[model samples]
Target chain A: MRIVVLTGGIGGARFLRGVRAYAAADGAAVTAVVNVGDDAIMHGLRICPDLDSVLYTLGGGADPERGWGRAGESWTVADELAAYGAEPQWFSLGDRDLATHLVRTTMLNAGYPLSAVAAALSRRWKPGVDLLPATDQRLETHVVVEDGDGQRAIHFQEWWVRHRAQLAARRFVFVGADQAEPAPGVCEALAAADVVLIAPSNPVVSIAPVLAVPGLREAVVAGPAPVVGVSPIIDGTPVRGMADKCLAAVGAQCSAAGVGALYGARSAGGLLDAWLVDEVDADAAVPGVAVHPVPLWMTDDDATEAMVRAALRAAQSR
Target chain B: MRIVVLTGGIGGARFLRGVRAYAAADGAAVTAVVNVGDDAIMHGLRICPDLDSVLYTLGGGADPERGWGRAGESWTVADELAAYGAEPQWFSLGDRDLATHLVRTTMLNAGYPLSAVAAALSRRWKPGVDLLPATDQRLETHVVVEDGDGQRAIHFQEWWVRHRAQLAARRFVFVGADQAEPAPGVCEALAAADVVLIAPSNPVVSIAPVLAVPGLREAVVAGPAPVVGVSPIIDGTPVRGMADKCLAAVGAQCSAAGVGALYGARSAGGLLDAWLVDEVDADAAVPGVAVHPVPLWMTDDDATEAMVRAALRAAQSR
Candidate 1:
């Protein structure tokens, strides 16, 4: 069986751990098309936060408590950069994490596309699932916001990490999405999959940017396979991260029903055939979309695996 | 009085520390025309060993025990790179040192020249002497050698750090020197200098590459100021590094007398007005150049300061 996933952020990475575990037992192959909107060139190093989050989590190098970056990470390089007073002090560039950037940046500078560089880095992490970037071209997520300075467009990282997303964002802009081509194998995987799962990542930024790649959303909605999106919201709050702020930016309510409405329904020319909400949000409804209430909290691998199973069942039933 | 010096490598860096110390007391200005020939792009970083050496040494951050890099350096980045199995593993890219590279590479990518980048770094380091690159252009020192892989010209870094200069070098090529211009302020510094001194660095790869720039040698040789050189060799042995191997490549004897002969006399259309040898090499001689024997070991700052004093005296006497 082939299962394709659209994923990004730490929560999505954690969810993939369960997907990978389920595949191990059922002998299913998994392909993850990760978001690249969060990628940026800082200090001449091409940094891929979403890609690294997945790689680290799946490769058993992720910090369990922090849910991001390498376990037992040191900040020697970061401290030195700080000492040198290098600008953009917000990004927590750990030493172990910086190694991945060094290698990736080196490879990209040597003429390889982002997909090729991701593949090369995956060789070291052995993330098991076939991992691909959403787009090889630069597709940055820029947040247009009115801060104390004035209304301006800032990179997603500056808004999310530096400013803590406090300033109300007017909207999110996928800078290069109009010209971006889906990375190789993204369309093929969607076409060949028995089911497509959107991991419980931030919808407005993580999953939206991945879908922003030209023709990517169309490929998912038009493909023959069933598409299911697992809600990141539970009890009117995000499982983690500032998904509420992102939802506010997009004029969406911070609730399971609201998120289900955002993805909409494939029958109504949207992305999902089935939407999996938390059991508590069982009554949540989206027009023309089949909504299933499942135990959505991924408290542990077993719990997450159970959630993945519920989504798969939802796909089959749809 | 303005003092201009042509220098490179670890020895030159140490020599500059003494020069800095001397200047602090004498209230004399010091301008260093540092060699860029030893510079190379490694793992996408513009690595300038000599420039960094001088910065770290004069900034009170150099490892006194090891004679290079940060005093309390950690190899976290390097170890992680090894874990990923990144190629060209010979360089010890310390975490603290890698910070410098990131800032430099970023600035350079943003179109700042090496000289500008160096000056910016010096602001943080407060390296007392005014530092200038030999040339703004990419003047790389490549070693043409016959190894097990057959005859080929490899980067100076690969030849020096990887092979330990054990490979018999046919010659050293200063690639880009012919097309290069001396960095801004280098010619001005040399032309206005009251005296010029050549630091006791590797003649083949270090000092030679600095002189390789068009019209730079003319600025020193034909300028009004007298030029004095200190011998890197004492009793037929180099103070540090593989200068003997480099000397052998260029077919110059590894002796104080031989080095003086290589620099020759300004009267005979060569560089040196006088040469300083260690007290032990009293009999060392070069026909056209006056050679003086003095204490030459840089055991500490005071000893190194004494050497600077001797060189200054020689410049005055000439």
Candidate 2:
């Protein structure tokens, strides 16, 4: 079986662990079309937060406790940067994490596209799944929020990390989505996939920005594969991260049914053919889409693999 | 009194400590025209090794034992970079040190000249002396060496750090020096100085590259101030660093008198009006320049201050 997973950072990375576990047992090929919307330049280093999370998590180097960055990471660089009084002090980049950014930035500046850089970096991580960025071009997710200074667009990192997503977000904007093309293998992966699974990542900011790429949404909707999504929300709340705030910004109810309906039936001008919600949301309903309730908490690899199996079953049924 | 010093990394930084101490007692203003020859980009970071050495040393952040970088610096970034198999692994940049480079590279990329960037960085260090780059433009000291690949020029850092300066070097090339102008305050500092002291730094790569800047050499040689040089070589050997290898590359003897004569006399269209050698080289002779022997080893701040006092005496005599 060939599987293509659309993913974001931390939560998606955890979900990928399950996917990898299931794929390993099933002898299935997996390709991850990772969202690059959270990528930003900090202290002159190009940092792809989502890509690094997946790389570190899958490569067995991620800080399991923190769910982001390298295990045993040091904050020497961040502290020193703060000492220098460089602006944007809110986002703390760990010393070990900064190395990945440095290498990525150097490669990107040397004319290599983001996809090639991700591939080069993966050589060290040996991330089991083929990880390709959603787009090689710039595609930052900007959050329009009402601050004391009025509504202003801020980078997704600043909005999420610095502000803790507390600011009343007006909407989310994918800055360069109109011009972005899918990374080298993205379209092909979608076309050749036996099934496509949407990770339990933030639907608004994470999956939305990936789909924002001009033709990316079209590729998945028109591709010859069954599309299934694992709901990031369970019991009207996000299992991890501030998906509630993101969903609220778009005026969507913070529930599995809301997200399911958001990524409506592909036959009805939407993306998903099936939606897998947590067992707690067994009563959730989405018009024109198959909704299945399954135990979705990714407590461990085995638990996550079970969720992946559930997602595969939904795809097969569809 | 207004004193101007031209210097490089490590040894020069230590020497500046003495200069600062002496200037404090004498209530004299000091300006440092630091060598940019040792500056290079590593992992896309603009690293000004000589400037940083002076900054960290004066700021009391330098590793006294290691003679470079932050005293309590960590190697997280270096280890991570190595794991990624990034190129130019020979020069290991400490985590704290990488922060300095990030700030500098960011500022430079934002269109700030190096002098301004150094000045901005100095706000934190408050390195007693006015620090200035020898030139604002690219002025890398490249060593011409013959290897299996035939005669080729490589960055001085690569030659020193990677090969350990073991390669047979033909000469040193001050790349981009011909078109390089003195950084913002360099020429002005020299013109208005009461005296100019050449710190006991590498004559071939350090002090030579400073002079290579267009009109900077002329300004120093023709300026009204008496120029006195402290010999990096003591007892026929460099007190520290690979000055001997550099001098050998330039076909000069590795001795106090040899260096003094290499600088020659201001009246003879060369540089120094006087030279200071170690007492061990009391017999050292420079035909057209006055040579004074004193303690050259910078054992401590007090010892360095004593040497600075001796250099001032030489300047007074001239």
Candidate 3:
């Protein structure tokens, strides 16, 4: 069987671990269409936070304690950059992490597309799943917010990392989405998939921006396979990150049922055939969509595989 | 009084320390016209080895044992880059040093001239001497050598760092020197100089590239300031680095007198008004140039100051 997953960074990376474990047992092939909206250039280094998180996590190089970046990462570059007083000192690029950016930036500047660069980097990581960026072109998520003065759009990193998502965001804008095309193998993976699973990642900034890539949303809704989403929210709270703040920006409720209804039913011109939620939200409901409630805490690989099994079952039930 | 010095990397950096100490005691201002020939872009970073050497050395951050890079440096970036199988692995960039390059590359890409970038960086280092790149343009030293098949020119960094200057070099090419102009402060500093000292750096790749800038050599020769060069060779051997190999490339003898004569006399369309050599080469002769015998070993700041004192006395005598 072929399984295609739509994912973001950390949260989605943890979920992919489960998918990989399940696929290993089932002898199935997995392909991840990772979100690239979090990518940005800092200090002339192109940083793909989502892509790197997935690569490091799946390749067994990620820091389990930090939930992002490499294990035993050093901050020599970050500390030195700060000493030089280079602006945007808020986001720290660790020395180990900086190497990936250096190689990626050098290759990208030399005229390689993001997809090609991703492939080249993965050769070293050996990430189990075939990883592909949602789009090779620039498509960053910018948050529109009113801060001190007036409403203006800022890059998602500035909103999330620099401001701590404190400013009440009016909406999220997917910059360059209109012109972006799906990266190589993305559309093909979606078309050939036995099931399409939307990982438990921040929907507004992560899954939403991936869908905003022109024909990507259309492709998922019209494809011949079932699309199932695992809710990033449980008991009206995000498992991690500020998914609640992102949901509020889009006027979506911070609940399993709310996010389920947001994705809506693929049958009703939306992106989901089924929505998997935690057993705590078993009573939650989304009209015209199948809801599967199960234990969703991915405390370990075994626990996560159970969640993946529930997702696959929900896809089949639809 | 203002003293101007033309220099290269490590050896020049050490020599500048002595000049700084001597100038501090004499209450004189020093301007350094640093060579840009050793500068190159590696892994998308604009690495200015000569500029950084002087900055770190004068700023008291250079590794005394290594004779290069920052003291107490870490190699996380280098190790990670090696893991990714990045090319040109022979030249290692320390993590602390990489930060300097990032800031420089970013500013350079953002349209700031390298001279402006150096001044900005100096704000952090506070290198006592007024530092100026020989030229703000892309004037790199490339060595012509036969690699198995035919003769071709490779960057000086590759020849020095990667190959250890083992290849028999035929000649040195100062790429972009013909069209290059002196950096903003270089000509002004030289014009106002009371005296000029050529540091005991490699004459071919180091000092030569600085003079290759159009009209710069003319400025030093025709200006009222006397120019004195310290011999890189002592007892027919260079104090440090491969000055002998480089001297051979241009078919010059590896002796104090040979190098002194190579600079000739400022009145004879060449560089020096006086040449300072070690006591071992007290009888070393340059027909048109005055030669002074002195101890040239820079064991410490005091010893280096003595060498600088000798250079200043030579300048005064002429």
Candidate 4:
């Protein structure tokens, strides 16, 4: 079976681990079209946080406790940068993580596209699934917020990491989404997909920006494949990160029901065919979209694999 | 008295430490005109090896044993870059050192000239002397060598570090030298100097590249300051680095006498008014230049200070 998954952030990395595990057992091919809204150049290094999370997790190098970055990462470089008072003091850039950025920045400056650089980096971490960026073009998520500057837009990383999303965001803007197209291999993967799973990531900033790529959403919705979206929100809170803050910026209720409606039924000019939520939110509903409830705590690989299995079953219910 | 010393490489760094110590006692303000020949962009980071050596040495951050880079530095980034199979694996890129390059590269990309970047970086080190690049423009020392591919030019670092100078160099080309002018403040420093000390660096690759700047050599020779050159060679060999190979590439004998004549008397249209050699080369002669001999070994700061004092005394003898 050909499976195409949309992934971003730490939550998506955990979800992809489950997908990889399930695909291994089913002898299925998995292609992960990763979000690039979080990618930014800082201190002359191009950093792709989402792609690195997936690479580290699937390649057996992720810190199990932190749920991101390398398992044995050091912070010598970051500390040195801080000592020099280089800006953005909030980033948790590790020494090993910096190596990835240095290589990526060099390649990108050499005129290689983001997708090609991702593929080159993947050679070191064989992340099982074929990793493709949502778009090769620059599409950044910037948050508009009221600050001392009085209504200014800041890059998503500054809003998410630097500010910890404490400052109330008015809205999220995908800077270049209108001009971006699905990167090479993205449309082909979606067209050939037997099942397209939208891994539980921030719907507003992560999945939205990926789908915002001009033709990406159309390809997934128009393709002859079931689009199953696992809820990033369990009950009324996110398992990780500040999805509540993000969802609030877009004026959506932070619940499985709200997310299901956000990624509405394809029959109603939306994206998802089926929406999977936790058992506690079994009453969640979206018109024209099949909603199913499953035990959704991804405590370990085995538990995540079971979650993936349940989500796939929900795909058939639609 | 105002002092302007030309410095490059590790040898020049050691020499400047002495100059700094001597100037502190004499209450003379010193400005160091440092070479930029060893500069290169690697992994998208601008690296000025000579400037770094001076910074680390004067800032009390240098590894005494290695005579270069930061003390107590780690190689997590370098090792990680190598694991990714990134090019130019021969660099001794420490985690701490990478921070400096990151800051420098970012500033350079932002359109700041090399001289301004040097001063900005000096704010952290407070190297106790004004650090000026020989030229703000791009002027690098490239060595033409006979490889299996026949005569080809490669970066000076590639020759010195990667090949360990095993490749016989045909000649040294100062790339971008013809169009380059002295960096801001360099000509002013030279014109105001009471004495100009040529630091004991590789005369060919190090000091020559700095002089290769269009009007730089003319400024020193024409200015009222007495220019005293300290021979890099002691007892017919360089104290450090491959000065012999470089000297041979320029078709000059690797001896104190040969070097003194190379930088012949200013009266004879050459750089030096006086040449200071080791006691072993006391008899070394340059027709119109005053040659003075002293124990030239930089065993420690005190020994280096004594040597500097001796070179300053030789300036009056001219």
Go through the candidates in order and give each one's C-alpha lDDT: 0.92, 0.93, 0.93, 0.92
Number of the top-ranking candidate, with DockQ as the measure? 3
lDDT of 1 at B255: 97
Model 4 chain B lDDT-worst window of ten: B259-268
C-alpha RMSD values across all candidates: 1.0, 0.9, 0.9, 1.2
A-chain TM-score of every model = 0.98, 0.99, 0.99, 0.98
What DockQ, between 0 and 1, does each candidate earn?
A: 0.83, 0.95, 0.96, 0.88
For residue B122, what is the lDDT in candidate 4?
Answer: 93
User: Candidate 4 residues A1-318, lDDT tens each?
Assistant: 888999899999999999999999999999999999998988878889999999999998899998778889999888888888888788868999999999998898899999999899899999999999999999999999997878999999999988999998999999998889899999999999989999989999889989989989999999989999999999899978999999998889899999899889899899888998999999999899888898888999999999999888878777
Tens digits of per-residue lDDT for model 1, B37-103: 9898877899999999999999998998888788899998899899888987898799999999999
- 2 against 4, candidate with superior DockQ: 2
- Kindly report which residue pairs in candidate 2 clash with one another: none
What TM-score does each of the candidates earn? 0.99, 0.99, 0.99, 0.98
Candidate 2, residue B140: how far the Cα is off, in Å: 0.6
Question: Which whole-number lDDT from 0 to 100 does residue A82 have in model 1?
Answer: 85
TM-score of 3: 0.99
Model 4 misplaced stretches (Cα beyond 4 Å): none
Residue pairs in candidate 1 whose N, alpha carbon or C atoms collide under 3 angstroms: none
